[model samples]
Target chain A: MIGRPTAIALIAVGVVLTATAMVLPWYSTAYGGGVEVVVRAWGTEIVNKPGDWPAGELSPWYGVPVAVTAALLVAGIWVARAAVAGAAGQAGAVGVTAALVVSERGHAVEQQGDFAVGFGLVFLVAGTLVALAGAVAVQREAG
Target chain B: MKKVLSVVLLVLAAGAAAGATLLPFSELLISLAPGQPQTAYVTTGWSTRFGGTKDEHGPLFGIPIVVAAAAVLVGVRWRKVAFAGAAALAGVAGMLFVHLLNVISFHEAGNIAIDPGLEAGFGNGIWVLIGAVVLAFGAVVVHPDD
Candidate 1:
């Protein structure tokens, strides 16, 4: 079983990972003549030259990860107040993370580039850890 | 509390997985000869091409989900042993569904490699279904035997 503070810490770390995932490299490609394109979880940026003009566009799915992280953050805080409810939150987060990972793979595999592991991967691992902690914490509370 | 939550998750997950078939699983655009590119939607476990993947593969991903849901509900209502079976089945179903998505994403739309500039990507349906299944499985794993 996990202690309240420890579970909180796990949730906090998970939330951070989830938040960072949105900005980190989900996918990247370098075309001919120094043209580079990087796709984040939420946005896509194309850099024409190393120090020239870079234009970015927000993906429609950008809000999905942000919303997920926000929920995890709230769940982390809730763990301090109520372990059972927080466990449910953690479980929900785990589901979302898993979904993102599986779906992202389909998109990731199709792209041609030097692909870096996306933030979605980070969130999946973190969310799983947080969920385990929450599960343990809830058992402790119940017992 | 654990049982209730698990049941809810299971049902919702099953629902989402079933719903995914209705939405486009993947989008395949094939540019066979330049300006005459064709777009196709992989919908409801059936593949379609701009010109013609109308394979009558009956609900590629939905049957297992329905079975899992029935198993879960039955397990909760009467036999506790059913939960484990349902979980195992759901896990397998989830993997198969994800694999199907992968195949759809990379495979040629019309049995030939897609041309350059053609797009192939996952749709919202797969995401929702994956998430829901994970949630269901996670709930089962965390459920306490009271």
Candidate 2:
């Protein structure tokens, strides 16, 4: 198992990455009209246009739990009882993120187009993995 | 008391997720160029998904809802585990509200203006989600020591 400081540092880094992912665009597209970006954690533009305008989105809801839980895990890492909660929270956040990734992959495969998943997702999954590892570390030390 | 509270919170979370999915995600007075402004509601499934593009987020709500429901069945007998589930539910639901505030009101697609009014009404479903988060958190706080 890793040292306590390293574990804490990992959680902190995870929080930073997850928080960054939350703000970054989950999906985006550039076209002749202009560049349009949608952050499923928060923003999407609904312009009335007839038929396939060539853009897609995921719910901003996906970003919420992953971010919030990961952020909280940073603090929760300190105490034994809280560490368990932190571990659970980390697991939940990772689970949700993984589901989001899978769901996006599903859409890309089913639909016939270039449904690009955003770069933020890479940060998100990595952050969750790091955070989960940190949580596990903390749990190991506590136990 | 702990078990009952845990069940209540988990059930409430599930209830909120159900509402979030079934009810309109947002009520909007969408104004796009070339057409008269029309009031419309977008469901959690994100109505736009059916159109040119698709949304993966709307359907993803099922995961948490399922987790919450399963947690309810498990009871707080596993207090920490239950609390974690509750905490997760709260995080996700609360953030949906946060997302609402961060929503984009106006944008242009190629020269056409797509403006959902700045004051697009917050739908009932969103409020329920907020409520779910609170209840879920309450369960975490009320959870008894093992």
Candidate 3:
């Protein structure tokens, strides 16, 4: 069974990844005539170009992952059984990931150069999977 | 000491789960005949708006929970079989939690999917159920026989 320390460490790792991705989302894109502008709104990277923006917009929903991470921290520290909090955190992370997946797929129909889902999305998925690993660890330890 | 703590946690969990059963997991518009606005509450949780889900769905999830609660209350008295009772409760609660996950659906749509609002999505009943599963698991792990 995975130990408690290991589980906490995994959850921490997930938090760091998710927080970093959310706080410093710089998914960039190049517009006409060597202009590059990517603005961070909540957690989504918006390509600020006139009449030309990326189709894959995980906007508004982007903040959910970071919020979930913060909630996990609170759950682990105060007013909750760590195991229970971890399980809920995993579910929250997975829900965010699912939302992102659908958002990505719905816009994947048109391939354009201005569209890019870079390290931010990668980190989000990785962070969610890592948190899930932590929750599974708690489950196994109990078993 | 472990048995005491386990039973305490189990009682808390079971009580919460039982209480939540009477609460509305999702709300729906129930029409008696036509054009009459009537709202009905459903105990079994399911997503009502997002991902093409509805408030009305299967309502038979309360049976196993009742049996699990009874087992925890009565079966846990016997120290020799306390672990079995805890395990049973955990199993039943865990399965119900799993089944309730379908309240929200996910898929690729033509446009970016919007997040469901409080009234249209999961209610407090399902949240309590999820937490109860975790507590039930705690009871299972810390049982004296285990």
Candidate 4:
């Protein structure tokens, strides 16, 4: 069974990773020559843009949603750790993450670049994994 | 007392969902335009901005609102039906909202080359209809109890 600190730590890690996912790929620009300009976790590059931002480059502040999702994940983890868990909170966090990932993919459709699709899928998978783990932990504690 | 409160909660939730979806930023623009050619272009832009075009953010926001509403209503009026209806409505609403936002943002950015054919995908108009029906039914069901 996941203890309180362990649950909190997992949530913290998830939040940090999610935040990195949002902030790392800060920008993307296409300069022809098949060179895809993108901001990576390590540095900016001329290849492999990370994800699709439906709001577009003008509104990088849209990363607010990612931050919010991270907060929700944290809350879910806390609730689960405290043994005050419910399907609503867990479902809500998972739903939001899944929605965001799907939305990102939709936005990437116009760009015809694979970067958004790749990152979106990653987020979806990550969110699902986190949700499952949280649910399992909560169930174990509840039982 | 619990039953009454549950019904009230459901109705409120549905109403909130309806309000959000019905009051999209695009609707604001369309009302402001009031019969202009730019309406089409503006709508496209609005759709993209809100992620309606591809992302479905707009629909996503609306879904939970609708689901919570439906769940409350069904839970009160017909307990068994409440869960499935609520879940389905919420999921559909969420997906559509996201797509709508994507479309609005895309068009707004002068991405005119983007096809407007995916307009129906977001499901904004449909959810509004569903919400309205739920509201009407909920009123009838709750009034008798009161």
User: Please, what is the whole-model Cα lDDT of each candidate in the order they appear?
Assistant: 0.50, 0.56, 0.49, 0.43
Models sorted by TM-score, best on top: 2, 1, 4, 3
Pairs that clash in candidate 1: B47-B53
Clashing pairs in 3: B47-B103
TM per candidate: 0.48, 0.64, 0.40, 0.46
Q: Arrange candidates by lDDT, descending.
A: 2, 1, 3, 4
lDDT, candidate 3, A1-143, per-residue tens: 66877877876787677666666553455445555544231634433444433332333443543464446543553322443444344433344344334434333323233544557656766866776577556545555
Compare candidates 2 and 3 on lDDT and give the better one: 2
Computed on C-alpha atoms, the DockQ of candidate 2 is: 0.24
Between candidates 1 and 2, the one scoring higher on DockQ is 2
Per TM-score, the best of the predicted structures is 2
Candidate 2 residue A116 Cα shift, in angstroms, is: 3.2
**Candidate 3 on B1-146: residue-level lDDT in tens?**
98789788778777776766655554433333345443443445222232234423234445555554555566356432333334444444443443233322211121122211212345576577657656766776787763
* Candidate 3 local lDDT, residue B145: 64
Best by DockQ, which number? 2
**lDDT digits (tens) for residues B1-146 of candidate 2:** 76677667766765665566566555544544536555353545233242234454443644654565455335446565556566555544544454444332221222133543323656676677667666766766776745
Estimate, for each residue in A1-143, the C-alpha lDDT of model 4 and write its tens digit. Answer: 68656655555555555555654553344533465655332333445334442323332233443444445566666455222222233243335434444544454445664443335335433643554455456535644
Per candidate, native contacts kept equal 0.00, 0.18, 0.00, 0.04
lDDT score at residue B144, model 3, on the 0-100 scale: 75
Model 1 C-alpha lDDT per residue in residues A23-98, reported as the tens digit of each score: 5765555655566666555555666755523321234344353444346355546543233333333333334334
